[model samples]
Target: MEEIKMNTIYDNEKFFNKYSQMTRSQKGLAGAGEWHTLQKLLPDFTDKTVLDLGCGYGWHCLYAAEHGAKAVTGVDLSEKMLAVAKEKTAGYPVNYLQADIATLTFPVATFDVVLSSLAIHYVADFKRLILNIKQYLKTDGILVFSVEHPAFTAEGSQDFYYDEKGNILHYPLDNYFNEGIREANFLGEKVTKYHRTLTTYLNTLLKNDFTLLNVVEPTPATELLALPEMKEELRRPMMLIIKAKNNL
Candidate 1:
């Protein structure tokens, strides 16, 4: 199959907008991993300042503040999404800023930790985004994030799904290595998301002085294991838990 840009499916503003709202499920799923990674990565976050990128409704950021984080701020390009996050994290020090990750400007070494969850996939210019985070993080600070599995995005990766009689079926997506913007409406507002392959993401982080530490995958909680569909997903790499540090 040939590669296709992210424009095909993400072209619909309505559907895309719905995806940006709380209707999106991946945020919660990825957020669960964030919770796990947090305890493992920063066990002593009580006095640390944090910046959450693409923080849809600030679930993780709020969790940090409730438990420990000295202060937390979230940034996203979609105001509607940020609005929801703002409401969800109301009465807390969690601040929300609406801006594209590409041109986001912040003070130098301003945060103790920078986190994102399945949010970086929407960035087309991954290199510049990572570099931009440098100014936001103090030395020895960690950038923790999660990403969709590349195997699912690879060409012909749908073989794992078979019909009742063993006939394989799939989403029929081409351009598995897509790198482009998906235009859509998020929360009734026009917005676009950029897509880049996993390799490009890794290379960009490495180029930006990020040192990889831990890469993890989520394990279903006891509740999810009872569900057949989720149980099957455990056999493959569905998501990634990446812990990286910017030496500078």
Candidate 2:
């Protein structure tokens, strides 16, 4: 088993430069494939304190602040990513922190809402992270997060199986029951991601006293479907979004 340390993969100059060029990095929430669906699942942010784990470029943090969140704290391990987040965030009640999502701590009942966008899959211990989230959230606080779907990670390739003629035949899936660290190639580099079954994702929250609200296997935003490549998303679920409440 490869030990999962503080993940600073996003800080690598080559990887950071390439990631900075992604549509999501440039256009914020509008460029995210699942934002259309995920946004609908979020509770109103009015006057709420928000904590965004693995907050990347802090799009969600800014959105919360812009929409009346009392305060927003965005945490990520990459100094470069945080630098960009801070540079773009001005006159908004948003704070950027350079910290590891797997070990960062917050006081109890510290926030009214907690969010993570496509980032939790990198943490090695999902249960511990959420347990801390449960403790940090106020009573009835909302938690919304999205991650790369297990089915997409099951095969370790995070890609499609193509035919001899070069058309994508299907997304390959195997070793699905075996969940753990996966070495996946992303942006032409080996990236480390953790895989957990859908059941584990839901059951962990249930056992930890979270009331399940909704589970989404999101498709590309409707407008994105017009793009030739986006249409392929219909064939497989690449992301999972979950909304839950602290049932205290």
Q: TM-score for model 1?
A: 0.73
Point to the candidate with the largest TM-score. Answer: 2
Top-lDDT structure, candidate number: 2
Residues 113-160, model 2: lDDT tens digits? 999998999999999998889889999999999999999988897888
Off by over 4 Å in 2: 1-6
lDDT, residue 158, candidate 2: 86
Model 1 C-alpha lDDT per residue in residues 100-216, reported as the tens digit of each score: 666787899999888887777667767777888887789889888876655544433333657899764543345657666544333444444554566776777787788888767
Predicted structure 1: lDDT: 0.67
* Model 1 poorest ten-residue lDDT run: 1-10
Measured against the true structure, the TM-scores of the candidates, in listed sequence, are 0.73, 0.95
Please list the C-alpha lDDT of all candidates, in the order they appear: 0.67, 0.89
